[model samples]
Target: MRLFSLLLCGALLTGCASPPPDDPGGTWINQAAIDAARESGRLREALLAYGPNLEWQIHPERQQASYSNGFELVEGRLQAVGAGQWQVTFYGDYEEQLRLQGDQLTQVASGYWPEQRFARAPTRGDEQAPLGSSFEQALYRDYLGGDWLIEEGQGQGGLVRFIDNGQVQGLPGAERFALCLAGDCAAMSGEHDSLWLQAGDQGSPWLFVHEGNRLRIFEAHNRAQFDEMPEYQPGPQRWLLKRR
Candidate 1:
């Protein structure tokens, strides 16, 4: 009887010591990190740690696609060349690359990336540049900059000076890129995330995400252009910053 009782206790203890429930909340991939990987075109390797620990041997030649968390994962075919630098061929024609330092990204877009906006450049000033001068640019330059609002309008506006601490100065908002003001505001977080004024629809926004040397402007959803007005669509747009 004594032996049976000891055995039962041991069994109960063993059962209790078994692995706890799985992490039902799922993996820890933030939208920013995922966007970073996708922009770098390294979506496959970025996803390696998301699922069960499986020994995945990435074959460059024969592997048509990779799988992660039920998403028929494909190789972003992103190449990392040391020191957090990466290059990607987005949607085939669009070429982009990024250099990441700590949490800052300097994004570059060329070839197909700027095809649509190329025509507008010759007629515009710094504001119309893909990297319109903004407080964010000031931060990148001095690492300590702020701005005041000069004007505001739909599709066009002017900021007296774009600054880093837009919140502290109580500056009225201005549209930076084609994204709406609200879209640009939501992208503001810490010193890491990029900032941009959304193009149209003050409510919908464009999120500035810094991944590697690249800073991408993205939308949270999709809509059609109304009477030549830019529409907000889901997915992100990566713009290369021409170093000044």
Candidate 2:
């Protein structure tokens, strides 16, 4: 019958060329390349010690995969393989190829191994920073370098200025770093939306514990998940700030 109808049309084109099944669930953060490296300034305080508050956490119905600097994804599955491309396959076997662009999700590794990007995390209020939280490494080596008055009390105060390049300023209406306004302080220099720095590019990465000079601020989840190698105590939420 004409070679069995050409072998049943080559087995229906090899079952429609297989490959395409792996959804993987929840958690992911690159916040569009951390908001495009905090808006072009190329924000890089060592990538804020890889702590932008938990990034990546697939589940695939329990196939497991976790990472926020702790690394766990012993096995993986992301496999989209088309339009925006994707292919994951974790540590056990190791494979990569993820690209998205719009919301950013890169990870096209091969040899040098660095790519990695991600996003899509804020589903609700978004707050998860407590796994050995050094508060983004003590806000990038001690309260984000320079200029801070913040004494909001009797004399009522505000004059932040942290600027290692990411830029930030306060003084004018200052509704607590309201994207800078005191006469256009560069319109919130490289926005990261600081509530105490929430992911590089500067300011409000939260969680502090200085001590001698006082600096205890913690509320972004109530802080208490130690493991990044110990040495960090001060959890009661006093919101004390002093580093002029």
Candidate 3:
């Protein structure tokens, strides 16, 4: 029966088809911010700060999520109410309603929150550096976390502030941390006086050493590079932003 065989084959193929990658099970990156950085001509700074190389993991099965820029982890009750739809309640009466459209997950703007987009990560966290210690984490939160005005002639003049709430640029899904949080400060050779910090995972990390009335900024890729050339020739002649 040719018709019977055709029907059976169709059923078999349907049963064996792989699931879509849209499920909220893997990693996501702040692509919207990345695009903004590229447009603003701060692609390198954006990549280091926002970490285009980094990833944010979402475990739908465990109802857990981890941000790559080393904020705190979020655990909540994730419920699938419909296809491509999920609601995560992290705290009392606080909800993070999500919508998955192909590669982008949008936290639909609700109440005072605005819409934020996160693109699926190209790779996982296996290839990246780790976030620093609990003690170091506290220091970073207190020391480096502040409202900063990206001074003119520095990099690109703008408001680069790290808020108490887990949002960068008034959007969700980003946090700031010490770029050298893994206890590698001493490795800065003699440039040890400076504090290196990273925000989002997009912008490049900047070194801040308290110099007189302002926190002088030195731009670099990461801590490992800084360790190799502490007396980095370019030296403290750029980025005069203050941590207000």
Candidate 4:
């Protein structure tokens, strides 16, 4: 009878409630939703959606829309005057004008915002090409659709080059790699992986880590001291990214 009661209790518990399965993706940050929150005033909600240690931020002004973290990078301004019409201004040394639809952003003037855009700059220990689309989407679009190839040492393989229309030859060491189309090399390499760009490093100012079988973008600043100016290297004691 005691054994029967134990079985009955187990059956009742199983029928009433079951333990939940672990999240396959673990904790993830939704960059788009965070960006949307900035556009719509739900920053806290967005932050709550992501787990701890995941940093993000949104900087939208009367004439610009910018979100930090993840892979999407746009140093620009956006102005919304209702009717789904938005005026986007790209920031560099000069200002570039662009028009944004629901999902498609197009450059209105030539010579300003180039029709073709480069992918995010590659860091050390990477071999992907960096071309196609724009850095804006390269950082945001998770399922970027297309084929990418990479060249390592002297042989061509399934990697991506984001430098020139995803057509550039594989990069030699020391040259920056670009985010390409194919998922090949989408994650990390051994020591040569995407890293956070350090501040005042004279190179790029941000870093992206292709770890955990996924690409995670981080904002970093360099505080290294050298006899001469050494090139960037992945290491600890680096500035980690904060919420954008």
Off by over 4 Å in 1: 1-162, 165-203, 222-238
The TM-scores, one per candidate, come to 0.20, 0.26, 0.43, 0.24
13-131 in candidate 1: lDDT tens per residue? 54323222221111111233233344453333332322211111122243221212221222334455555555544355444454444423334445422211001111112222222
Off by over 4 Å in 2: 1-29, 32-80, 88-92, 96-148, 152-158, 164-231, 235-244
Q: Output the worst ten-in-a-row residue range by lDDT, candidate 4.
A: 19-28
Against the hidden true structure, what lDDT does model 2 obtain?
0.41
User: In model 3, which regions exceed 4 Å deviation?
Assistant: 1-22, 42-56, 66-70, 127-244
Full candidate order by lDDT, most accurate first:
3, 2, 4, 1
Once superposed on the true structure, which residue ranges of model 4 sit more than 4 Å away at CA?
1-63, 67-94, 107-112, 116-193, 196-225, 232-244
Ten-residue segment with the worst summed lDDT in candidate 1? 115-124
* True lDDT of residue 59, candidate 2: 49
Residue 212 in candidate 4, Cα distance off native in Å: 14
Better of 3 and 4 by TM-score: 3
lDDT of 2 by residue, 1-244 (tens): 0000111334445432322333334446545434443334233322442333325655445645445532222346666667756566766677756666665556665763566665544331122433212222223323345655666432237655644333345633222222111112212222222233322333433334344444444433322346432222233463455667
State candidate 3's TM-score.
0.43
State in Å the error of residue 242, model 3. 24
